[model samples]
Target: MNQCLAKKVSLQILLVDSYDIALNATAQLVKTQYPDGNIISTRTANDAINKIVNWQPDLIIMDIYLPEKLGEIAQTKTGLDFLQQVMQKYPKLNIFVQSPYVKRLVQIKPAIVKHQGGFVIADKNVTSQEMLSIIDGALKGFTRIKGITDIYIYPDIYEKLNLKPEILKLLSLAFNEGLQDKAIAAHICVSERTVRKHWETLQAALGIDCHELRNQGINIRVFTKIRARAAGLID
Candidate 1:
């Protein structure tokens, strides 16, 4: 084993969620990976803010929706509100927000990006492997979360291209997995000929010529991914 892997580094992590079962289970899972790390769990945004201020954790894992009712007369504070506050107060803090709602992610992504902090939004149902990867990436200063491409694609560029929803989905699949036309057709329940048509439309719209790239030993699938990232379609 590498000496660094054998040695444990001390870290402090905070997990904020309204569900007690999920909160404790996530804490235990993280504890196993970071044996020397401290994990704190909180249900409400207020408690999370307090812990964040006092503990100064190295990473924070939060839910997009958190209970914020203080009383009948008190104004309710949302998880997004808390996130904005945290980002403004501690610009360099690492934060991971989980939610299954795509619309919510779309609404908050720009703000997170503008904050320029180590922040990532992940699906709530992420697998254990994906969860670990996201956490590791955040600690290493990566802002993009795995399997969430909609947030990466610039809406302005997408609109400028005037691509249909199906075309956008196809491009995302290609960029993410580099799937061949047949494989993509199978996944989308379409014929291979239809897939080729869509690919040709995308090439014409994006000004990419597959035949030209092939002559230079560059596969179109790989080139599409590179171009998407260059165009801010994928991070």
Candidate 2:
């Protein structure tokens, strides 16, 4: 590879997080690895993306949720236009997009690949060194990983709420428009009361009163985003 292309191996990275502590933790983690690589940390994707445009980092590591702008939707740091620019100008650019929720990553994968980015498939329990190696591999032009993804649930919320693995499957069922509780219960092969009880537990765990969150938005589509933000997805 040419000097400029080889330099991309040590390319800087940007991180956009809505939650203060998570953003700082992630920035510090990256600094530990690439001590000299520019780490553009910000509170919003807009600012992060702008810095990406200027600094032109070879990679970006972003969590899905943010407030003020990213709000409930855990959008990519660089929106579609910026993604297009990345493909055009920095075809070798790497992106590691993560969320606390695996379902979110599954849903968002197509979009990530559209921008030529990859996912980290390791379980959250993996060591930080293992996770860093996943990121390094991506920068080196490998997209396939046998383990879990890098998107971690911010430790703040992760510690607060211990969600069951089944919740996401149940949520995927609930996100359907016009799906009644009875139908969801049937899908889960549980009684309606059981379904309601689980949903209640989910609401309580996230520290959001279900009725209140539901009151704010009638559309089921926003529930994924809402649950994520409620889980403190700033990192």
Candidate 3:
């Protein structure tokens, strides 16, 4: 290697997160490792996209939920779509998803595997040392998605069951809001029949046994919620 080329590159980190506290905390934590690192922070997907296209940072630490624009409510789909676009365009970009919703990345596991760059995930609540360790691994091209790799549900299973991201939204509505099928349909602007079909699909994907539930005199919906919670599909 040329002597100049062998010199270490200064780390460049881009953080895409709408929340100020998390963004600032993560930036400070990263600075602990690379005191002279360059960090760019963006609060919206559009802003982050522009930065990524122009700057090509060495690594990106982003939340899976972000606003599409300034002053907009942060949304998971918006961030996920942005991430997909980034991955498609920059297959070798190192990425770390820092959020409580890391499980949602399961919907894009196939693409992650196809990516040639470092990819890692950690819940927002992890210790600072753990976060730094994960970041180090990512910069070295390692891949790890916490709470996602240990699950029995694989990407192929998600494909086989057609478990789209919308299913995650449906689960949140059903369990977090305690919404019935009719109410969920109204909220999501879908037909009641479609909501019922989603429930059936979710139940099937969870390997729920309706026969056993009936025999045990348990309400199928309640049992499904319990299973989904245990599976980390819902809070």
Candidate 4:
């Protein structure tokens, strides 16, 4: 939140999909094409919005038909409604809604502008690069070089530093940006001492000095995630 931090800020993109296959393919394409850009996706609209608020992504790639919960029963919600909320609160954020529900978007064009959200009405059949283009036009506002594929493709970077999931999650939570170790431990339902043991194992595997990995949680996390992605471990 520092002024200096804002000066060096990069564009963020959020992909919201209720379905995993569509979300993962889109995410992989986007991230593969533009690695430097902080592109992230979530299955839950709430979690999507949470990251949107925290990361302030310049664009949102959204889909319809969210799982719903009404008392004991679950219902459904539109991804557009979620987009509308983003527009209301973060009008500057651009959006590209990709759904088979193009007719609904045509019906609701008025709402799109009312919320000040941008649009790229995409069918389920749209190609990956076209989706990339929607994201491309928005990044210019952030003063980044357009259409240069800024995403970091460092599979070897992750490959060089292998780690397990439990340790990976802890590193992402605690090491990156110095999140509290106690909080990370609590989230994993383990003690701080146990977390340290995991760290020790990671240190041994990566050939990193224990003290260095302890301080560089984000780096450790990135390596772990890359390795996981390479191994296709994510669901």
Candidate 5:
């Protein structure tokens, strides 16, 4: 590998884990990819926050089960709250969550989406190569958290968006099943007029205007499908 391009001029990496073995092992693996990296390890959320505020590391590899302070029992909620705080304060910070309870991340899906930085997750049991690859990907601004199917929207906001089940079904049938509007109407036992109405409603709910799309020389259906998928309204 070209050292210059691969290493990115030596990154500042922060490893946050209360376990000495996990922290040291991750730092060693990071050294293999970034030989000249400045790696810092912190065992508690307070120390991690202090290091992050002071050093502003390029990447943060953290565990979900972490303690808030020395001599405190590590809890998933503590780490999660700390992670959320960090993401809020440094919206563009690259974060790599190396944890076994990756599923619990679904709770903060909304904030993750709003983050303008690299956010990647991997199970703690992944192979060294896989973990390194994910870390590399995070450095390159990749957001890949596998098995996370939904992005949580607030209940009131979701209701205000007016995303009804029929609208979601329409999106799935139109995009997933590859059906035309007419065919979608037939499949759902609705009239073509009602199907057209559904399309108009869906477009409005998604904040997509058909006229605006036409003005921009864009395909409305295609754009809608892309937007729906981005919003987690469809597969």
Candidate 6:
């Protein structure tokens, strides 16, 4: 709840990327969009962290793979590590994360959402207009963007969760598209009863009770979608 975000006044923004061209291009784009905004660009996680501590920017647009040197080592810290540090220190700061690897974004998204701060994730190839739209929405306190959420999937999640492919498919169909059990069964070429059996198995495997989530004021479908993404089944 930064007042600047609500008031739409002059803002401070930090842009962090390893690539010079992308970093400059994004900074220029932000300057064009918010003429009064102060834009600071950095190419390493260490520099970005230093700027975060000293400048305390209102918004940060950063890559997810900033490989930076530490002490004698050539490369030590990662952008995800930087992100965790930033979140721990500035829980309310808005952050926009861009990465070429969609799976990495998916892996980190749940943590970002759990922080309950302003956050958006998009591919590095996102159009300038789309990037601006995402920035505008995030500044207005929108935590999730359709463009990002629609394509998020952590590829290693299923293996990590030890989930069966069949169950994963069912969850993806149901959560991703809001399909009912019967519709899911139709889509998978199975009987509704079979779908129900698989659903029960899946619940046991995930150790999630839909009723409990409902009582916690969580939408079952949305919760399932998060789980699906976490399990790398969103595709």
Candidate with the greatest TM-score versus the true structure: 3
lDDT tens digits by residue: candidate 4, 1-235: 6866865675577887777798888878888877766778777767877798788777877775454322222112345456667777886677666665544332233455454445555666867777677666554432221111122233232332343447656655754445676787888998989877775665454444545756766566556544433332221
TM-score of each: 0.57, 0.49, 0.75, 0.50, 0.61, 0.58
Q: Assess candidate 1 and give its TM-score to the true structure.
A: 0.57
Off by over 4 Å in 6: 1-9, 70-77, 145-235
- Score each candidate by Cα lDDT: 0.71, 0.56, 0.83, 0.58, 0.81, 0.71
Clashing pairs in 4: 12-57, 34-151, 35-151, 35-152, 36-150, 36-151, 36-152, 68-75, 175-217, 176-218
Candidate order, TM-score descending: 3, 5, 6, 1, 4, 2
Across 1-235, the per-residue lDDT of candidate 3 in tens digits comes to 5655544576789999988888898889898898978998989999999999998899999998899999888877687789999999999999998887877676666788788999998888889999899999999999886567766363344664454557777887888788888888898889999988887777877888888889999999889888776665655
Task: Rank candidates, lDDT, best first.
Answer: 3, 5, 6, 1, 4, 2
**How do the residues 1-235 of candidate 2 rate in per-residue lDDT, one tens digit apiece?**
5878766666577775667787687778778887867777777656765687788777766554544255545443224334444455565678665444333443233344554554444433457787688778766656753322334333333333334445544665665334667988788788999877766656665555556657886643356447654442311
Q: Which stretches of candidate 2 lie over 4 Å from their true place?
A: 1-10, 68-91, 114-126, 145-235
lDDT (Cα, tens digit) per residue for candidate 6, span 82-162: 887888888888988776644544434556666756887788788999889989877776686444465544333434434
Q: Clash totals for all models, in order?
A: 0, 11, 0, 10, 0, 0
Which should have the higher lDDT, number 4 or number 6? 6
Return the TM-score for candidate 6, rounded to 2 decimals.
0.58
State which candidate, 3 or 4, has the greater lDDT: 3
Best by lDDT: 3
User: Tens digits of per-residue lDDT for model 1 on 132-212?
Assistant: 888888887788744345543445444444444466557756765777778888888899898888877656555688889
Clashing pairs in 1: none
Angstrom error at residue 165, model 6 = 21
**C-alpha lDDT (0 to 100) for residue 164 of candidate 3:** 56
User: Model 5: which ten-residue window has the lowest total lDDT?
Assistant: 152-161
Candidate 3 differs from the real structure by a C-alpha RMSD in angstroms, to one decimal, of: 4.1
